[model samples]
Target chain A: MAKKSEPQKASPKSLDVSELMRDNDQPNFLNQMQEDFKKMMIDKQVLQKCIETFLDEIIDQLTLGIIFDLHRKFKTKAYCLEVKENEEEADAEQSEELPLSPVKSSPQKCVCPNCAQQVAALRFARHLAKCMGLSNNSRSSRNASRRAATNKEKGASSSSSYSANSDDDNDEDWNPRMNRKKDKSFSPKKKGTPKRSSEPDLAEAINTDTGETDEAKNLRHTRSNSSSPDSLSGSGNITPKKRDKFKKMGKGKERSSASTSLKFD
Target chain B: MSGKPENANGRVSMHLDVNNGLERVTELIETRLIESGWKDRVKLACREAITENNQNVPSVDHLIEVITPKARALVPDAVKRELLHEIEMIFSNIEKGGYTTTLDG
Candidate 1:
């Protein structure tokens, strides 16, 4: 055999060479190589196990991280969507109500006659009064007096004196017409002989009468004349003939004055 | 018996060097894991390392691929890159030696 021939050839060499040949035997070499291979495989397995554990840990972390990120993103998206929906709903409600607003507001809008500007109806009365230079208090008082006067005129004649008294009590600052009316009503009571009053008193009455226009005086005279003679006699006792005489005299005076002015011209 | 004492001694020293390097790598990894709030993961990895079958262990490249996204999620881009570089450097350093012995030394 080749192996036996090799050992016999080595046996002729030094002892060290035989020992080296024995040590280099195939079985022993193969065993050593096998042992080395096993150790290498074991080491590789150990290293692989360590890496696998580390990688598994990393994978777990990555999965958890991804899940957490998705959760946060979903939560934010949901919140944003909810907020957007609420805003949209509110906008829709406002849009639905918008059509009715103009109709409801139309009556509430008023145009100021003085300024020609649109104002709220609730404020228009105050604005108008202010535009007319009337304070709130004065306007209210004026309204009250006007109401009182209308009430008095609708009542019986016996209530005239009470009306005057009420007017005097309410209106300490009476107008010129109110003063004249009070004077005329009170004058009849003071002067028992109404027709025989002094010339100056008559002139004063005429002057006061000038406050009425000529047409108004004529209308008043015609109304008095048309009244029943019994009512006239009962109120004043002045003869109709005397009233006619006074009228003729007044016409003659006016005619004389006009003729004199014509001759002078 | 035929091997030189000096060669055996060199081999032993190289083995010790490799062990030390591995220990350093493990310590660095543990420190980073703890700092990044992966303490539970570290415990789980240790358990898995002990319990898993040898054949089923994952490769270094696969492990890196799995870890990249996780690290990216935990740290800033620059920090992630730096950590990955550091891990790669450790592996490269280890790889310079043969799989079984310190060929580089």
Candidate 2:
């Protein structure tokens, strides 16, 4: 324990600052400081060099990236321009060839008669029907307006004819040419009405009103004249006493025809 | 060395553990770059270079060169230095084992 204590005491005396200063330790301390400075400078230079190299690497990478990006952008732009140019050239060629071709280039379209609008041929019928319906509505509105005007102008005289005229107009809407024929035939009936009030003449008038053709009217007239009770009984197809019954049957047929015509009127 | 004997199995396992650690570090870095939106730009640079050269694989130095600027831009100086140090350490270890790293282009 004494020996350990003696070493401790000796260590303190060896570290005496005044004694070391008297022996001229100042130069040695300065030299040590200079050496430390040199080492620090060297360390600083090394660190600077490392930082510069890192920065240079970063710059080189950035430059390479920019170069690659520019190259790709230019390549894509050139490709797009080429494609656009090719398309333009194709269009120009087609336009030039169109006039040179022999076939007439009429557009596939039709004109709607009702509206006078040009439409594709495939849709023409549908468009025409729609336009016609529209026109029909307009015509019906016009007719109603005209009826109002005529009612104000001719009041009582026009009322009786108005019903017949409206019916004729509706029939004309379906077949204008047939209505003209009916109008011509109707003129003769108006003239002939005072001349007869017999059954055959009444039947003929009913047939005309029903718009029967001249041939059908003539055939009906021949049948009515030929189908007498005497002729039917002479043929002996039925019993002789049944002649009166046959006459009654002919009258029934005429009545039925009259009823059908009345229904139509 | 203090805890266990330096056997062949131990050496192989250490190497595998180091490789796994390096892979995880790389994944973390990639995730950071993607989050920063720099991954696509780096990948584009690498892709263009690879395609122009008609290369199937890129050198590690080339990949680092293409990615370093973007990495520097996205990461702080201290973090960038730490990341570079980690990458250097991984490369040094791989070199020490005489292993070559192959990256697909």
Candidate 3:
């Protein structure tokens, strides 16, 4: 109508204004954009999932600070709980069986009120270290005080209840006065009688087993257990030959064994 | 965030995840759709890069803490500190906001 106004809409083949769709870079740009969009979508989803998991973990950790050892095995996985001191003392008398072994092969039917977990006798020291941060340094200082108390009591009484029970233990308190009794150096061969270092000989025993052959290890292990208080004390005042073997083991255990066995014997 | 085509020629980009606060995760995506069936160079490169990261990252867990602040907080103290310096140098520049390209060339 308007007399071919604006020139009749150009034919499809004869169009000039980019044909409204045939721009050179549009498809390429679009294809790239589409790929990017897909990747971005996947990444965003993964990120969201991660955030959700992280939040869930935080909640679980905070609320469930402690957990129960469902299986009564220690080596694999176990968690200990912190309970009140009063609970410990109150239960002491109730625990009639004593420390070495309890009436139950497993723990009592009590759960740590703070964190619901079953306690184990073997892992109690480790648990105390972790949950309570009770360090070896504290133990050492406490031991020093204990030795001082023993000194005071040793003067007052000839045979205390503590001494009666553990008569075999070579006395750690090497009160310089006892050293004068040279023949009584180690009644059981007066081995290398080192003093009370609470570092468990168990670690040493385990380490020795790791290094040597099976036969050698068995021999060493047997020697460690059999080396009595007498053997240790006497070993401390040993010739160069026994001392060589003593060095291979440890000083403290051997010495304490040698000296105390001789004096007490 | 808007990654303004950092390594377009190399077919990789140091992209920032917008949801995350500018974490410079290296992304290598193919622009051309492999004329039906071609060797995917981009995927190969990505695999190699990820492999490289795997080799280096674990050993450097401890060092990452002093160097890469976020990573340091995540990892434990007992971890070895080998990877810290290299990663720290990378992130420190990104933090400064001037350098965009991963390499000089």
Candidate 4:
């Protein structure tokens, strides 16, 4: 391991440059920097070709080895079945042991490598709101302000003077017609903005008050609205005024009321 | 090719009168066939039979030791030889015609 560590050292200046690239001030600067690095790494085109050819051969050999392994697996089917069974048993054990609540708890780690932000559960809601281009909508003014602060010092390049989306100018200019198509595609002339054809499906509120079955109340007071009867402890939330509305109805009527609007019932 | 029995040309069988009047009539069909210029065809068939499945094809020694006696007991040696040759020819036909290739443009 000590012997392997001999060539591990890199110039500190390169590290400093990489850190600067990650500093968020230069967003598209990473592209130009990578191009420069590639040029420096391969001064000769012939040398680059040779390296690429060597890499391709190595990749070919690796793929051939994998294919051969798969062929052997096909020949012995029993072993593969055993491996599948083992994986299933492992999954069962993990589920039985952990039983994690699906809900987000506390500040979870963000998947983005650089940001490493402590993301609260509300962050998902905020992110969804942002994705709708709600930045200028004023409701999420705080998030928009935060984005502007981070994006303003974004690109130190002279090209930064232009609008933020100017970076996409290359694509827009490549095919001028494409820009028109993109504009048309982005702000699609939604031929028919589907009007909420029905109120319940859109609002997702099945009138639990409708599945009236006095017999069902006698059989099991647990409302068929939710599978887990422990929740929905009270019925005041649905209509606020209606009580024991579904007093007497058949299973079909019960199912219709239960699923009239799946989002909420 | 060895013995020219008197009825060799006319008849496709031969009766060998052995000791104590025990007579054995061997079918001369294969001998007649070999005489009829099918040697090259027979050799080609044997080669193809072997090539078709070298893994399953019995060696000559195994054929003579194990297979020939059984065939001889079931049928006359000469007829058995012809049948074996015919079986080999069938396998040879498959081996020769089964494979194909595409022409490059």
Candidate 5:
């Protein structure tokens, strides 16, 4: 039996060598190789999936390009214009409207609801404050009384007889509280006169009612009373007094010429 | 035949649409781009475009306006050459496969 086993197993040493070779190629080694292959497959699948996501992102961008090109080329003109407007809207940075108060120009007129008169918008608030008899009422009335007193004192101080006539004429034109009897008196005095004797009576009425002083009107009244015969004889010549006033007011040469033209007219 | 002489560009485009040839060409182009790593480059370019648009998802039209030219320029020279060669071969094959007579008719 031993001899038969020896013949079948080839020599014992040869058997030992064959068994060692079989041991080297064991199930554990094959199992590890199989596990490594499986791991490699899983890693490859994950990488492929990641690459797919990148491909999808690029494809999506390409689709956008395709759609854009198609729409730009084939869309109707109105549709294209609309798309363009929409794109402009999107590209525009979102600007929230500020919760700010409205600003108005200095020369704009606002109609006063109470008086039904057009007032400069900038002064409308103060006008309204006066109408409402606000906290500034006493101070404003005091200032107006002081102005009227100064004007009366100036009129009285003038020694010339024409000064009194000029004062009476100015008071008739400027006094807001005067009745229609005084208004009727103004026209008869200005009758057949080439002068602007009734100039801006309505504006003076408004100025006096609002307790506002018009220096220009006062200066014109003073000039009429104080005009020398030589100055008044020349039609378009500026009086020395007017030239000095213009110079002190920092007005240009054109204004002096314009004022001279006004006097002649 | 349609009263206007057919331009070379028109003829080529007509042939490209025959027998799903355009689809096959598209497949070849996709494969070439994948093989040449152009797909990855395009993805990176797309990412750059998205970032440049203030990281806001850009409108499709705007994205097209921004990326199409760049993608065209970013295509590798070798891939472009191969694609051109493949298209030429497809044209030659169509000409030789007795389809040209039908196309001319």
Candidate 6:
């Protein structure tokens, strides 16, 4: 029993020595482990921050690259033309590139179905208006202003200018010649222009206001040598005031030439 | 030029096929891109390409050529990381013999 107690005491002493040794070592080890852990956590956070920043930089660079690439790809010479004032350079370049195709600058030509005359496609509508003798004063004035504006800008094209002059000459010639023929007789000319001669006469009938009904209007139109109701009906909308003006102008037949020329010009 | 890694890649892809993992990854990437507004950004870029030309609308092929490289570069890193992680998971699953059981099931 005494031996067990003595050994128990000795064991306690050994345990105390071991405990003291462990106490000395533990704090240092634990502090080192804590420091290491803290360092690892900080490192992880820093690494994450670095990666995020890198990603952001990469995205920005890519966006910039995309913008530059798109700008380079889509910024074309034609796009600049809208903002540019001068088109002569482009025209000169085009002319140089297609020196063999000088006729490209000229307006296209088509046969006027009514007059059977070759007319510039650009001026074909106006030519048709005069050839059919369905001239509306307001519409013609608007068209003349539009044509003059186009002519000012397109003055560079010689063929278009020449076509414009010829078109004016033909319009004036047709007006005077048709008036002379109608005054002499109601005979239709070889060309289709005089077939429309009764149009002016129908305007005169409407201006005279001899009819209030369609049948009466038809009777008056037929009496004026207009056999076609279709042509009469088409021109029937010419206001009395305009027709009266025409009649007032027609009182002086020789002076009507100058007036008609001035009206068209 | 590769030896073992190429075999590993092939095996990983084969495993992905077994698990229908490739399609899921693709769907995930597409969803991520859409959620991140990357798709809208790309669409805006395409519109800009079309409208910048004054004379005529640019050809589809030309637009694609101009935009494709930048679009590829613009994919978010998070999506790329998730995709790479998914691939790693596929590889690990293959290594763990999960491929056989999944194929069997």
Q: CA lDDT of B79 in candidate 6?
A: 81
lDDT of 2 by residue, A163-252 (tens): 675554444333433434644576643633332334455444443443445455445545666655423323233454574475556456
lDDT of each: 0.45, 0.46, 0.35, 0.36, 0.47, 0.50
Give the per-residue lDDT of model 3 (tens digit) for A90-111.
6986675476465446565443
The number of residue pairs in model 3 that clash at the backbone is 28
Once fitted onto the true fold, the runs of candidate 5 whose alpha carbons sit more than 4 angstroms away are A1-265, B3-10, B53-55, B100-105
Choose the strongest candidate by TM-score: 5
RMSD of 2: 21.6
Candidate 4, lDDT over the whole model? 0.36
lDDT of 1 by residue, A143-212 (tens): 4454455455444444657657556533642342354464467664353332223334444455346434
> Which candidate gets the maximum lDDT versus the true structure?
6
* Candidate 1 ranges beyond 4 A from true positions: A1-111, A117-129, A132-136, A139-265, B1-105
lDDT of 4 by residue, A1-265 (tens): 4223312321221223333334454454335433433342345443334333332232233333333443344345543586689999999999876746544344554432222234455465555444333555542453344345434434343444655534533333323234336445643333112222233332333435323433444344354556332222333333533333322223334445545544351
- List the pairs of residues colliding in candidate 6: none
Q: After superposition, how far is residue A230 of candidate 6 from its true place, in Å?
A: 99
Look at candidate 6 and tell me the lDDT of residue A232.
38
Second chain only: TM-score per model? Answer: 0.32, 0.33, 0.20, 0.26, 0.74, 0.71
**Candidate that beats the other on DockQ, 1 or 4, i.e. the better one:** 1
The TM-scores of chain A alone, one per candidate, are: 0.21, 0.21, 0.13, 0.21, 0.25, 0.18
In model 3, how large is the Cα lDDT of residue A169? 23
Which residue pairs collide in model 4, if any? A25-A154, A211-A246, A212-A246, A212-A247, A212-A248, A213-A246, A213-A247, A213-A248, A214-A247, A214-A248
Fnat per predicted structure, each in turn? 0.00, 0.00, 0.00, 0.00, 0.03, 0.00
Tens digits of per-residue lDDT, candidate 3, B1-105, equal: 111222221111122221122222211111111221112332232223324544342222222222233221333332212122322333344345632222122
**lDDT, residue A71, model 3:** 16
- Interface DockQ of each model: 0.03, 0.03, 0.02, 0.00, 0.03, 0.02
Tens-place lDDT digits, model 6, residues B36-67 = 88866875777677788766777656775777
Q: List the pairs of residues colliding in candidate 5.
A: none
Q: Residue-wise lDDT of candidate 6 within A1-265, one digit each (tens)? A: 5323422443311323223224433334223323432342345444344333333333444454545554554555443454353577788788788965755776689898854788888788877776555578543454444345445544555555677754754564434345456445643333234423534564565545633455665556666755333333323545667545555544445244544654565
Worst 10 residues of 3 chain A by lDDT: A66-75
